[model samples]
Target: MEKTLSVQGMSCGHCKMSVEGALKDLDGVSAAEVNLEAGSVDVTYDSEKVTVDAMIDAIEEQGYEVS
Candidate 1:
């Protein structure tokens, strides 16, 4: 499944990389795309392996806020 999350505190390419990297590191996530300009993240993940809350927490762990 795919999920789009609104995220804050991403100001540059590095921030985007960090957020994307964190999400992609999760077990169920197959892909993550972070758009710093859009302040959002698009993630493709397996629902059976992970939950939305977990995905949110993973992004938050990288020092960002997701809504």
Candidate 2:
């Protein structure tokens, strides 16, 4: 499944990569694209293994807020 999360506080490429890396590290995540300009994250993963709440937590762990 695919999920798009509205993330705040991403100001640079580093922040984008941080979010991407964190999400991709999760077991079922296949792809994570962070658009700094839009402050959004596009994620593709297995919903059965990873939940939206977990994804939010991963984004938060990277110092970003998901809405």
Candidate 3:
């Protein structure tokens, strides 16, 4: 499934890359598109393998906030 998460504290390409890498490294995630200009992340993941909350945690782990 796909979901768009609102993110905060992203100021440049590095933040975008960091968040993208974290999500993409996960087992269930198929894709993670970080739109720095829009402050959002479009994620395609398998729910059976990962959870939305886990995705949020992954983003937070990268030092960003997901709302």
Candidate 4:
């Protein structure tokens, strides 16, 4: 499944990398693309292996707010 999450507090390359890395590190996540300007992330993952709540937690753990 794919999900687009609205994230806040991303302002630089490091922020983008962090969020992407966190998401991609998940077992089910195949891809994570962050649009810094849009403050959003597009994630592709297997719903059976991971849940959206987990993704949100990952992003939050990276210090970004995912809503």
Q: RMSD for each model, in Å, please?
A: 0.7, 0.6, 0.6, 0.5
Off by over 4 Å in 2: none
Which candidate order results from sorting by lDDT in descending order? 4, 3, 2, 1
lDDT of 1 by residue, 3-30 (tens): 9999999999899989899888889999
Off-target runs (Cα >4 Å) in candidate 4 are none
Worst 10 residues of 1 by lDDT: 17-26
Number of clashing residue pairs in every model? 0, 0, 0, 0
Rate residue 51 of model 3 by lDDT.
97
lDDT of 2 by residue, 1-67 (tens): 9989999999998998899999999999999998888889999999889998999998899888889
lDDT of 4: 0.95
Taking all chains together, each candidate's TM-score versus the true structure is: 0.94, 0.96, 0.96, 0.97
Name the better of 1 and 3 by lDDT.
3
Task: Summarize candidate 4's per-residue lDDT along 1-67 as a digit string, tens digits.
Answer: 8899999999999999999999999999999999999999999999999999999999999998987
TM-score for candidate 2, please give it.
0.96
Error of 1 at 42 (Å): 0.2
Root-mean-square deviation of candidate 1: 0.7
